[model samples]
Target: MNPNGRRGVELMCTGATSNSSWMKQLTSASRQGRHGRVLHLFFTSLRPGDRGAADTHPAAIPTALRACARLGDASSGRLIHGLVLTRFPSLASDAVAATALLDMYAKCGLVASARRVFDEMPRHDDLVAWNALLAGYARHGLPERALTLAIKMRGQGLRPDLVTWNAVVSGFALAGDDQMAGDLVRAMQDDGFQPDVVTWTSLVSGSVLNFHYDRARALFRRMVAAGNRVLPSSATIASILPAFANVTDVKRGKEVHAYAVVTGVEQNLTVSSALVDMYAKCGLVLKAHRLFDKMAERSSVTWNSMIFGLANYGHCQEAIGLFDRMLCDGARPDHLTFTAVLTACSYCGMVELGEGLYRAMKEEHGIEPRLEHYACMVHLLGRAGKVAEAYDFIRAMPLEPDCFVWGALLGACRSHGNVKLAELAASRLRTVEPANAANCLLFSDALASAGRQDDVVKMKRLAKRRRIKKLDGCSWLESP
Candidate 1:
């Protein structure tokens, strides 16, 4: 059994079957982000009848709902909600309990359900419910709806507080509306609320999402200049580090690292993961590995980042080893983890291992293959000169193969001088990416290499007729 499961069993052994004891464990697990443990404790404490441990300890229901929210287990959340209806019907009228239900639905991406709960709540004066619903809409890509709800909240005479303003600002910022986010910040300031770390972090995170790396850096600098007034939090550090990572700006990344250290957020999982990613992207893989070794905790993101860095820099063997270690550490491998490991297998020409991992990913881990995973498999087989086998794999794919899949096949065919398969792969690629001149250009080169002058001419003519010209590639160098 896993360590957590063993610990939970021990807790159950010592708790003497008391509902309060189970509730304490449930609340503790939920607070610690151990949602799975929270669920386990909650369900184990339940009896068959309506008046079970859950009814005796009504507070545990909201805590369980919160765990369901964190896990995105909407089915389980609904079960808990139904339990409340049947066993603890009075909880539906308690604002705190009802608000927890509303928040859970919102966090689970069930915005309509959240809105329904908000509308049905007995009290309209509860600003917590309003904020919960507002945050739900704001977070779920309906910034306009969030703003509308905020206005409606004001109409109900519940004056918008700092949290209310931050929710709206975050919504706009996250949606990439920098101008609107700025306007909201000024508006919040006018209303006697200054932009806090959360406010600045939202703007920084939005800038990063919108590919405004320079703007994100500038905003981070401004936030730092705020000095003791409003310090950068772990979220702030994590959000801004990606900008440096994407730009390969190691100097700036190092400065941020020093700041994280000074702020004592260097040990934070998210910040540490971002730091590893930044160092790796900046061509400091060894340094990244060192940092990874020093980390006391490693999330899936941390492992994936390190593995990708190793795979990308020709450390395929080490990358695969790290993946095994990740499994040993009991970190559940996600889609990205498979992608990184498969990439390593592809890079090292470990075709058999790659195939085994691919099957295991589906059969053992239950992670259905995504397009990128299929692309990686194709690349793996194609790189090993298994051109026909790669094509067969593509045919067996549940998804319609994208340009990357066909492109990998074509590139492999070119490498192995398989002109016939190259032509077929190029044709499919062109069909998928009709305006991509690179497809025609690649096929033209393949034909030229095979002494098919007429076919090469035809490919060039097709590109010219379609007005499809490959854009010139460029590179950026960070100034010293």
Candidate 2:
């Protein structure tokens, strides 16, 4: 009734009675490229952990495998693989089924098993197996091995498919070999294999993951220019959003938002949340909030983004309110949520309230304090002029304190004229960051407040000896 041939089978299901007919739908849906629907139908067809005749059901296995790849949920894929090994070992030898098995195993990080499966098979040289193994190596950051396998596949008179080419390109990207990746893209084009959104997204992701922000932005521009040639996916939008966030490029961020809206790319939950975070981080929280409110669905990530954005822009009370609303909405707050709210409390000098939330985080929420949470607590207590208690808190910490924890106390010492504690904090700071001129200056200020001019002069001389230049001040202003 939906008119699309793809949905025809669902209509047929109303009168379908036979188990074989149901299994037929599995193969049918997969062939129609309804991967998510295939998975949904597959799981619903049987109860969890149920397997009998369907174990060797050739059609069922491959569909499940494809679903795993689509979901990027390796655990589900591996479970399917385990079902195969346990039920029908012989079906694992069929070329199409075996190749799917190999691909699933490789993608799920069982490369060694995939290789063993490939080696044991009579059709070991099948292009599918070759591509699967190559992709495994490429995905796991073995660029050299992946490239070598590409050559070997060629030597064996096997032409690489689009998948093989993408894996190799992605491998180079993962290795931070941008030049090699670019060359491969050109070669791929020359070979008559036009890159799809996955291919371009992989390249963009590789650049972003490796901190090549400029290259990422340039690649995004290239992606936009070729948008007519290959439509970008939600993933492509998500991958490029962080590049705009890192640079605070609000103009480009707006362009990306428009692109996502125009392309319907923001329909995906991850992309929508990423857009929210990008807007929030680019000094555009109002825009971020509008998008957040508009999202029909949200994960903890979206809520965390709103909370973090509010705290970052000095909306402490609002951030705390949002945290309460998040809990009431049945969204469990993670360590990051607590860290953001605790930081807000610290900023607002609500020491008792901050400590209560810290305890509630562990007792009520069952989320243990990570280092950043401890850092927030230290900053909170220290800023309240309870320097001795802060020091004791640091000592009682089960985990080792980092420079941030000590730096918080030292900053407090400077504010409160606690010269003795400042000396201890400064001494520790020197071990952590000997060249930090601001910390040194703060230490000197703490000493000067106690009439210790000689120590202040010594601090300045030590800074001069180290030749550490003072950090330049930076501020933002809105243009009219």
Candidate 3:
């Protein structure tokens, strides 16, 4: 069904009569990221009663398995496994073919199935198969299993290599076991394998994931200061940028940006996208926009960040315009895209447009409205002084409204002086998030705004009885 894959296979099959030629085409398509083409070629080449097609194409089996691994098409991988069992049973004894199957299952998160393939391999001495299964366990949050497997592998006299060490280290790092990950790094160094860019990037990424932004930045600095032995790759740049973005540390962000530009990774898609996001979160919308516009390629992340930046800064129309351009450029909008544009609509009081897009999101784009989408709608209608309409919208919701939905209604009721609806919204919000004193505070404010001093006093007494105290509000300010 993939048009490019189908077209590529059809055009190249003109002289692919021999089994080797068919394998060349399959592997070529996979390497080109045309995994769909590889599948198409694989299945189509298996003719009716053509046992030779399956039996002779031993090389094609591993290539197809690799494609299945990349695509995460486990069902197709199973089908190929079945074919190998029925038609090309000799492939079951081939180490390369069996290893490919093991890797495909592992990458698809089928650790058990990958283990079965690894165990059933004609030879257990294949280092590549061991690493594939080890990585599968480690990558899937079973670092302990990976370590045990590595010990067993070493018992079999197969020395652990750089890939094996990095796999275990990455597993611990990704699981947020920084102490264990560091110990593993030192251990690998003792084994005469110096930590490379993958090792450092894993540490940096793990720190970022755990919200240890300072530690992530420090590790990045250490990696950079390690001289020419290992410089920050694009992955390293992309990983550390989020730490800066989350903290709104534009100074460090710009320093990293300068590094990226000097290292010629400025044009890399992921690095550029992260830069756009970093600038946007730092409140430098103009700088974000400039970087966004200059990019030759923009992903949904790039577009969403720029749109969100514009919407957050009161440039609602510009945000909406950019969304239109995104559609015109044939970029598929995801849920975040609609969230960004709906936010713009709410900010600019474009209630009708928001409604249309909400419907289009479900009908045209097939993206079901999530809780955030419902919350945005309530905000759009409520802020437009249509408090009654917002209440009706909440009533008609397919799912039960959450705290954000009722909170939007309560906030709207307060702004528009709808005391009755405000009380209802606050009650529902309290039921949804009972511990949040902010809801009670807003409801009390609504009562005060409606000149109901007696009701406000009663609410205060209720709050005191319930032991609900409003938390102090704080804001993050840019450093001087």
Models 1 onward score TM values of: 0.94, 0.79, 0.85
Give lDDT tens digits, candidate 1, residues 213-241: 88898999998998899999999999999
Candidate 1 — what's its lDDT?
A: 0.87
> Cα lDDT of all candidates, in order?
0.87, 0.82, 0.90
| lDDT (tens digit, per residue) of candidate 2 on 1-480 | 221222222333333333576677777877787777777776665575654436334457766887677656677777777766786565566666677777877887777877887786665457767988999989987878898999988888898889999999999998899999999999998988998888999999999999898888888888888758877788988988998887788887888889898888776899999998998898798899999999898889999999999888988898889999998999888888898899889888899999999999899989988889888998898889888998899899999877888899899899988888889999898888888888898898898899999989998998999897898998544232
Q: What TM-score does candidate 1 reach?
A: 0.94
Ranking by lDDT: 3, 1, 2
Model 3 poorest 10 in a row by lDDT: 1-10
* Clashing pairs in model 2, backbone N/Cα/C closer than 3 A: none
Query: Please, what are the lDDT tens digits per residue for candidate 3 over residues 1-480?
Result: 111121222333344445376667877898898998999988887867655654555667788999999989999999999988986676676677788889999999999999998877756787888999999999888999999999999999999999999999989988999899999999999999999999999999989988988789889999999989999999999999999989888888999999999999999999999999999988899999999999999999999999999999899999999999999999999999999999999999999999999999999999999999999999999999999999999999999999999999999999999999999998898788988888988999999999999999998888888888888888666545
Off-target runs (Cα >4 Å) in candidate 3 are 1-25, 40-58, 73-89, 454-480
The positional error of residue 263 in candidate 1, measured at the CA in angstroms, is: 1.5
